[model samples]
Target: MDRIPILRMGNFLLVTIQVDLYDRLAQNLESDLVQMVSKTGARGVLIDISALSIVDSFMGRIIGNIGSVSKIMDAETVVVGMQPAVAITLIELGLELKGVHTALNVERGMQLLKEKILIEESEPDEE
Candidate 1:
């Protein structure tokens, strides 16, 4: 089983996918990422998929699952640097990827995360 490394960046978790994603690897990534969010109390997750030229439906679901789980953990998820082909594939596959934000690159992704965090922080708690 191949493991994709998850890096902790302050209040965010960074994952840069450098290798091709397989079913097992995708599953591992989803579980590992959600666990990491809980363990680290992260406020956001940034996934850079610029290297992947194509994404199958399974991979797309895993990505969506990661975002959904992160949100449940009170952390935002941002997917950045996705190639046009991959985006098209995901759309064609009808992968909505709810709760996921997107940016053009890592820098922009980080910025988006920060903005979201700040907005969340400034909002008054309902409780």
Candidate 2:
């Protein structure tokens, strides 16, 4: 079985998509990632999709679902390195990827994750 690699770096989980994702693979990634967050109690998730030149609606929703689910688990998700075509396709699909933050690359995504964690930490919890 082929699987996407999810690397843990301190309080973050970094996923670099290096291959095309089939339906089963994408499903596995979603399940595995959430499980990883539960196991590691990660503060953030950074997903790199630079290798992918094409993204269909399924992939877009999977990405969006990852962000939403991770947020519910108290982990922030940042999707980085989206190609222009992928971005355009996502928009055309009418998918509003809520709760997902994006960056140009992994470096900026990590920085944004740090900032998100710090900001959320410093803010008072609502009643």
Give the C-alpha miss distance for residue 34 in model 2, angstroms: 0.3
> What is the lDDT for 115 in model 2?
98
Give TM per candidate.
Answer: 0.93, 0.93
Q: lDDT at 123 for candidate 1? A: 84
Worst 10 residues of 1 by lDDT: 118-127
> The CA-based lDDT of model 1 is what?
0.91
State how far residue 26 of model 1 sits from its true place (Å): 0.7
Candidate 2 lDDT trough over 10 residues, lowest sum: 118-127
Q: What RMSD, rounded to one decimal, does every model reach?
A: 1.7, 1.8
What does candidate 2 score on TM? Answer: 0.93
lDDT of 1 by residue, 1-127 (tens): 6899999989999999988998898899999999999999999999999999888877877888898888889999999999988788788888766768999999999999999999988788744
